[model samples]
Target: MKNVSADAINALKAQCRGEVLLRDDAGYEAARQIWNGMFDRLPGIIVRCVGTGDVIKAVNFGRDHELLISVKGGGHNSAGNAVCDDGLMIDLSLMRRVNVDPKKKTLRVDGGALLGDMDDESQLYGLAVSGGGIISHTGVGGLTLGGGFGWISRKHGLAIDNLISAEVVTSDGKLLTASAGENPELFWGLRGGGGNFGIVTSFVFKCVAIGPEVYSGLIVKKFEDAKEYIKFHRDYVRTLPDDMTVWMVVRHAPPLPFLPNEVHGKMVVVVPFVWLGNEAEGKAFIKPIQEATPSHGEAFGMNPWVGWQSGFDGLVGHGARNYWKSHHIKGLSDDCIDKIIAFGDTMPSPECEIFIPHMEGAPSHVPADETAFSYRETPFVLNIHTRWQNPSDDKRCIAWARDFHAATEPFAKGVYVNFLSEEGEGRVKEAYTEAVWERLVQVKQKYDPQNLFRMNQNIKP
Candidate 1:
């Protein structure tokens, strides 16, 4: 990192429209905090960007000073690349703004906006974009850049599938628009290339008519029955329609109202799903899962779409030491199901979970080579979400996740970029195919050849 002079800092403060904070400033401490508590870094300077102008100035300043720069947009990534030590941090938390065009069924969201920010505004008109994830506080920018998916993804598509355009600021401080008609190559890269190319100031997404309410809920099965239930689930979801999505989670059960007191804190297989269609049809589709195995408890009915989006917020709340390992699997083999059950039995912390989300519907229908995201045909994504609060338990928690992930690696074909931690270059390559990786490298060479935006899962020029 370069030593920035006091004069230059003052000049930057005078020119920017937003707050500038140094280590000693009032909001500096708060500004440096991100979703994962595992990373505790101290950036030399933090710029709270309010708009595109501030982002341009900050990017230019960071480049001119030759400083290590990190960009923070909702700061929810598992890798914690949103903040860096001894360098410039461009904070975009203040730029959250969402504009919905009902007539066109599209929305333009600022880079800083959270998934909740977009959901709240769009749901008012009974419209939404796919791939915001289950957590509402997740950032729209990070999610979309890494091929986002969520409850509606099976019906609509991945977040990148809905992305229509983006306003980007390159390393040289030039603002440009990327879409199918303009800078088409950059647009393709932005769909799933992570944040290596540039800083997207805003994004325009094509929305689908989803809901103000939807049929969704959770079903908890006993750990004793997990082995059989998982095998059944693996085949059951394949028969369902795209309008319904069911994901499996193996973890110690939370004390929800519906579960028996004896089941609380016990390892269980929880199936959560969302259906875009009406209640009766949704119930008919979910009936098989309900009767698949003798469940310990279950909850299913109509729920507010926005409410369901943030339903798991409490379990995944920020400020926990989180380490994640993930893989893309075509199907859950018998051996894979056994490993998942075995890991769930020995979970280091109650917060730790093995998340297996069913994929392959609308997104899979798109050709693999059409965009930088190449794992379109993957039918399942397994995420080893290891979370704990105590620093002393870090080694145990991380090791559990790693061992579990390694045990299941043989069954996996690829991995999700968004679910990755600070794993090395080799692991990053697993997120893309050879052709897509080569194309992404070319785009990087054109827009950011010097690699100023190396804080993300980088594709080097």
Candidate 2:
């Protein structure tokens, strides 16, 4: 890797509204860091961009110097695609800001803001755009562009589904606003197409009034009950209303005060549910799910959105090795349930878990052509999230994930790109159909012919 040009560094310092750190700079190590602990890249420059103009200057600098470019919004990509070796990283973390127009029922958020930041701001007004995992730390840009799905997904749709508009800087260094009525094709591509198009600077979303308080918590069952409970969860989840969302997980419980001491290291099935409506109806909707089987332990009730988001933060966070295998399923077959439970029963580490999210309701209601996101027809997404702290255990965890996926592939439809890693071009192509792939390539050619944004789950120009 070549050393960063002193002249380019000087220009960045002069023109950008952000801090520029060369590889030899004091804060270089920290600025180049990403969420996935497995990746170790050394970027020549990391620009802690303060605003959209700063992003433009950094991009232009990269282009002028023929430096490969990567955009870091939340730095949480399991693939570690947000930064690159010997490239220019436009880090947006400093640009965190949210502007809410409560009367207008809309929110304009800075590109760097995480889902948590957006949720906190909007929830204060009893408003939210569909966002990903109650985990508030997921960045809006990465999640939205990759078609975010979480508790509110079945009701409000993908994070991109609620996106009203986005301000983007293209490869040519021109900033433009893309929305339904303006630069419509680019807007369609951004919905689920990852970051192949450009650097999204700001996003305006149509927010819906939700809860300052809601029904959400975990129901833990013994690992021995995984077989029966998982089968029941698969069958019963489909019957849930759009207002309720749930994910079935298999992992050892952390030493939470609420968790019993004896069960701290025991394998367990954690079924987390969130009901987004009136308390009475929410309770009624979840009652059938709660009654599906006897639980060894259960924790459920109303809680603030922030509390809910941060509840599991201790278990999953930055600096843990993350390897993900995800597949979208049209139906959760009996065999699929058996394989998932079997894998969960032998989880290699406490951080390792299986996530199966139902994906019908609002996300599927939008026409398949409405966005670049394919597999909307799929009913469920099964993710074998192999996470651990020890590098020596990486191979074992990866082996378990691969084996688990092999056993369940017969029942799966395709993979979710957002949950993907460096599975190569064939797997990337398989994430979408030939038609969707062709159109995405065309859009990539139009907006980024040189493939300036090629660091993501790239769609070649």
Candidate 3:
């Protein structure tokens, strides 16, 4: 661990209201553990920030000490950038306070608030932002910084699109609120810039009226029918309305009550979707896919928005080794479909899956330069989610994901920064267009010239 004088540590502890944990501290081990188990790092110090004041203190301390700093929001990143081997880790897990304004149709979320926190509060007011991912435990801070997307993206646009403003603490420890009207340039960079500029303490987002409940569910298809079904799915989804989104995933069936026990461990193609409109129309829109391929098992109907958001939580629970390789494709061609099916057939682990989410609706309508998230016109995002529980299986799981990624690279236009693992700088560049990257560099130079916050998918000054 990097050496810090006891006096200095005590001074930090005195200044901050939150916990300052050392390696031997009671909760140190638990505080340092992030979502991805593959990263077993031991940070020299962990500041469990309880509020913006605590965050500012931690930031100032890390900068003064010239320590490598990693910021942990929900700690759900696949790359495990939330922790470092020997550095200062600012843990925001304790600051999860979410406030909703039903009249204004807006919500203000703390940096540490999880998607579930936001969803639970917003749904109470019959309002929701468009961009949190399917998993409810994802951090609002990291996900929004990386240009979040999920069930409602097609209708409402990316998380960045709905972002009204943010309260940011820069490298110099100056707290500033960025919005379209205030610090517009920095606001643009924050949209999809991944955590390069600074630490965001809280976020203000515009919410759309979605649901107390909506129509959504999963349909499982046998692997034998994946090839043809996927092709038809690709063509069929193009005709879908903006209010509906259907994503395809290939993986071994999990032991859910809906599926027979015999098919539990078998490879299958699962089509999961959410419709923000009327139940009758949603059913009519989803009818073609159900009729196109024979399903092994299926479940579809009206579910509480919160319930559907957390439905897959069991499958993606924390404490697993994860390696993700992703690509942004304009369209799913025949060759790409074949490669995806082949990889699905030989999945290294039951937890591994090939996720193809259709992208392109409200987000696509925005100009590329409008926000740092430049892949606005891309039609599909292909993510190779390689997951397993054992250190012994790491090599095989990672190799499988890498090979599958390489096989599908020819059809890729770019990639999503959030889905990236520790793939180097070149892959990072792929996340942004050249023009947007240059602009981000300018913002970084102005706010973080010393690159104090370089732990994330970095955009260096």
Candidate 4:
């Protein structure tokens, strides 16, 4: 990190339309804080960028001074790459703005905007964007760049498939547009390579006509039956239509109104699904899972898309200490099923759980080399979502997740970049195939030779 002089800092502050806070400033603490509480790094300076102009100014200042830059786009990465210790943090949370063009079947979202923000805008016109995260607060930038998958991903495609164009500011301080016909290679890299190439200012994604109301909710079963249900699901779900997507989870049961009082705080297997088409058809889609396991609780019917998207918000809200380990698996092999049940039965915390998102429809058809998300062919992704509220329980929670993840190593195809932590370069390499990694490196060298944007799942030049 370069020595940031007072005069240079003042110059940067004057150039932006937003606030710039030093480490000692009043709002600095809040500005530097990210989604996960486990990472406790303090930035030397925090710039609350309000728009593209602010982002440009901040990037130029950091580049000129060779300052270690950490960019924050809603700050929701589990790896805590949004902010870094002793660097200049470019905070884009305040730049959230969503524009919906219903007739064009497109939605343009600001780089810093959250999924909830985009949903609120697009849903107003009875339009929907595919491939948003389950949590509404997840930023459009990181999620989309890393091949975002949501309830509608199986039907529509990953967020990158819907991405028409991206407005970006490169390391050279020039703004550029990347799409199929413009900066095509950069476009491919951005789709799944993450925020390494540049600072994405805005993204225009192709939208699909989806439900203002659809069938979506959770069904709970005993934790002990997780392996059996998973075995049934691994085969049954492959037969389901693309309009319906199911993600299986095993964790301590929440005290939702549907669950029995005796089940509250007890371990359970949760099967949650969302159907993009008709309500009746959606209910029928998930019927097999309910029949496979003796359900302790079930809730399935027509519900607003906004409600379902934000459904998991309370459970994994910000400020919790979260450490996650994820793997793209071939299927629910016998060994994988056994390990999932083994880990699910002994969750360290109520919030700690396993998430197996099955995305094997439209997203998988895209050629692996076509985009930076090389693990597209994978059918099941296991995420050891380790979360806790207490500081003391961090070790136990993280250890359990690590052990579970390591135990399933033999069954993994590769790692998903989005669910990756600040793991070593070896693990990061696993996120991409050698061919894709080489291409990404070439793109990184062309756009960011100095590696200015190294905060994400970095593809170092």
- Between candidates 1 and 4, the one scoring higher on lDDT is 1
Model 4 CA deviation exceeding 4 Å by range: none
What tens digits encode model 2's per-residue C-alpha lDDT throughout 259-290? 77898888887888988877788778777766
Q: Put down candidate 3 lDDT per residue, 1-461, tens digits, no spaces.
A: 54579999999999899999999899999999998889999999999998889989999999988899999999999999999978999999998898999998899999989999999999998888898889998999899999999999999999999999999999999999999999998999999998888899999999999778889999998899988899999999888988999999999999978999999999999999998888899899988989988999999898999999999999888999999999998789999999998888889999988899999799999888889997888989999999999999999998999999999999999889999999988999999899988999999999999999999999889
Error of 4 at 454 (Å): 1.2
User: Which candidate model has the greater lDDT, 1 or 2?
Assistant: 1
Give lDDT per model, in order: 0.92, 0.85, 0.92, 0.89
Model 1 local distance difference test score:
0.92
Q: Rank the candidates by lDDT, best first.
A: 1, 3, 4, 2
For candidate 3, report its TM-score: 0.99
Clashes, model 1: 0
- The TM-scores of all predictions, comma-separated, are 0.99, 0.97, 0.99, 0.98
Model 2 scores a C-alpha lDDT of: 0.85
Which lDDT tens digits does candidate 1 get at residues 1-461? 35689999999999999998999999999999999999999999999999999999999999999999899998999999999999999999998999999999999999999999999999988999898788999999899999999999998999999999999999999999999999999999999998888999999999989767899999998889888899999999988999999999999999999999999999999999999888999999888888888999999888889999888999999899999999998689999888888888889999988899999799999888778998899999999999999999999999998999999989999888988999988888999998999999999999999999999887888
The better-scoring model by lDDT among 3 and 4 is 3
Off by over 4 Å in 1: none
Spell out the clash pairs found in candidate 3. none
